[model samples]
Target: MDLTGPQLCYNYTSNVIGPGELKTFKCPASIEGRFVRITKHTVASTALRLCEVIVEVNADTCTILDLALNKSATQSTTYDDGKDHAGDAWRSVDGNLDPNMPVGQSCSHTDQVGHQWWQVDLVRYYHITQVSIQNRDVVPHRLGNVSVEVSETNNFDIHSEFYDAKLCHYYEASDVPASTLLILPCSDNIVGRYIRISKFVPILYDVLSFCEVIVEGGDPSCIQGTTGITATTTVTENTTDEQTDTTDSPEITSTTISLPSTCPCSCRGSIEKYYNRSIESLLDELREELMVSKKETASYTRTLVSVDDGRTSSRNIGYVGIVLLVAVGLSIVVPDVVSLAMYMKGK
Candidate 1:
């Protein structure tokens, strides 16, 4: 009997996953070896589910139809006719219909339709690092059973992986993963082109369904939009004085000089030249000292004469001393001569 082939399946599974809705669907055992492609996808932005279907075929087994749970991306399908879906990337839902269905997971949803489980792999296109899912949106939605798969090639399961539609452009990662967060090794520095996020439970309206996705490593600016600093100082005042060598403030080193007790007139002249003054002042000071020391001799005569530059003029001490010495010489000689003449006349 011509039982089952590809593309031919039961009624296309439909779901109303909102605030309070949940359901599960499955194909009969007779539909093995067949493929099921997504024809329609609709769900609110606040419901938590992994409700998506796909006839999964992997390894050495026949195709098995399954559902999904808590996934990364949300509703609003984009027809591959080169045009993306015209609706919002996420939707809103109210789960008033059902409340017992479980939630879906991102980059990690495994939908079990009966005796089999289906897993989505993101190795082919995405080098995923962290998988974050949360429901913080003001408009809560539901996540139906969604399926995901990965592979290196385009189609045809390549060893433990399923293939997804190829996309171009880097998807931004989340900061606060407003819903649920999954830390993944493949997420940090992931590099892929496609990530299909579908529903998990056909019927569990876990209200406030959300998923936050993040990549691992690369340009932090490109991922998180951040940029990283230095510091500096102004010129300081030098402690060493700048005027030390300036001509304005001459530096005088200590020095000492010794002179003999007495010298010829030449020495006096030299002393006067050293002081850059006339010798009259020096001689006046000496005369004053001599008059004070010993009352001037009887032969000493007061003489008034302008010396050179100023009032101290010349009271020549040397001249005074010479005059006294001559007077003493004459006095001694006269006494001796008078005695000798008396002796001669008496003889």
Candidate 2:
């Protein structure tokens, strides 16, 4: 498994692909990024586990936007232009320009909720792929329709355009696969001047909800190609003078093993821990067997000692006489030591 893209997402092979084996789905990689909050989302029906949900983004390069109050691009007012927004009623779908957004004017919005959006140069962060949003809006906002627009004109703002999302590209539950990973690719490491992420309805209906937008800089799900295979060659000596014994010669045995299928999304980690624990248990069993052998050897040694003590034969009596002689020698040494000390003291 390559840990290059994401530690979690990887190519998974099913071992039982032959017959009526059940199919399995792999989890997506984690993305870390900035967020906007939505308060509503319903309980998911899929049994798949999301190991961890994080949006990844390079902050020094991302541009944000909020249209509630911020504006972008302003220049010398030209009311004489036939496209003046003040001259006609602006519809939600009509590309209208506010007086505040001229050709050179730029603004920023720090929402009371701290949703800071970039008002000027919205194109700085345009491309997006794989959008995972959590509708913190409490209940599904009945946002059956949403519009995503891309414009180069700096005259319009995104806030006045939320309901105006008619011309923009957006997706719905019917259009998007439910309870599955949403794939978006336009969010790559791209550079642009304007990007507008507008939705028709906030996914949250009653309460405010948090929605996560994920833009992939690179193929976060790309798996590295399997490396080349390398096999070591064993050199065989034709003959050897010390070959009198070949009883412990090494042997090569090959066994086929099937890969195990674990939920990478649900459980994050290596299966080696399980394998190591098993090997430890086997080693412990072997140790127990060795302990049993040591006990048997000790029991045999005790039997031999007992048999020697009970023997009345010549060998046994010879040992007994040698022990008695040792005792007499010790007795003689004790008296000599006392006499030597007494003579030295002239007692």
Candidate 3:
């Protein structure tokens, strides 16, 4: 069996399988497909058989989401055995895992050929994680070296081939087993809208078959939204303190003052002139106080000099009075002496 859309999706092949044995195949990447087919190569002769076919989906993690339920499916060819049909691929994905019906009702198949394929279209892009395929219980060994691939473009031109698709997973003869589901995980995180399953090598037969294909992943664009904040600035010419708006704007608490027009040319010059005039007036007051203090000091010195001269004159008058008293006593004593001499001579 082969899976394809505009590009090749997958290819299935194997050596051989025992009778009444079942198997599975898985894809590593989530594959979106619009078509699925089963056929044979021009040089090989082998028929395709399938008990059922399944497709699943997943998101961010490894959890599986049933995205293929009731989705559209198609095949390249159907078996002439009047029992199986191409729509059986959809019934296999309808939550039915066991094949207890008749042999024709149990699976889907195609005529013997080497270039047969099957495909499906997911209609959108998803972050795919894993794909699983279940084999039919009748003849599962036909799916041996199967390759599964995915792509977004639908360029299935015969001349160009399906060159736009990328390989998601591939299995060899040793990798296929009997009576078990095959699981493939996408290690490289492959993303696409179309999934294709195809068989490249012919083993027991050139047939490609599967019971189901499941895809799982999350939406690539289901992210949360965020809000952002913006800031604004305003500029104005010839603005004053009174005209400036402080609400919803930065505050200006203080400002510089200019000199009044009635004053000097500049505020600094006016201030300097006022300071010089005040200093001169203070200096004149100090000079007047100093002159009055000097006049008082000179008057005090002259009074002290006049009082010393008066004391010297009073001391000289006292010496002259003592000399006069001594002269009067001497004159009285001389008269007494002359009288006494005269008395003696007369005796």
Q: Judging by lDDT against the true structure, name the best candidate.
A: 3
Candidate 2 residue-wise lDDT, 1-347, digit = tens = 33344233334443323221223333444443234222223375534322234332343222221211122322111122333322111111122111122221211111122111211233333333233322222224322233333333445445443222112235545233222323333422222233344333323221111222222322212213311222333434344666645565543232222223322111224533443233346566779876756545878878866774544696778989999999999999999999999999995
Worst 10 residues of 3 by lDDT: 222-231
Better of 1 and 3 by lDDT: 3
Residue 26, candidate 1: C-alpha displacement in angstroms = 50
What C-alpha lDDT do the candidate models reach, one value each? Answer: 0.34, 0.33, 0.55
Tens-digit lDDT string for candidate 3 (1-347): 35543544455666564443444445456565655554545466667666545443343333436444345554455445554444344543444444332543434444556555556667776555666666666566656677777766667767323566777788766335554567777545456676666664344354666655667655543312211112232434445767655565543333222232232111335354333233346567779867755436878778866674557677798878888888888899978888999889899
lDDT of 1 by residue, 192-228 (tens): 3334444333333232233333222222223332221
Per-candidate TM-score against the hidden true structure? 0.20, 0.23, 0.42
RMSD of each: 38.2, 27.3, 38.8
Cα deviation at 120, candidate 3, in Å, is 1.4
| Clash counts for all predictions | 84, 50, 66
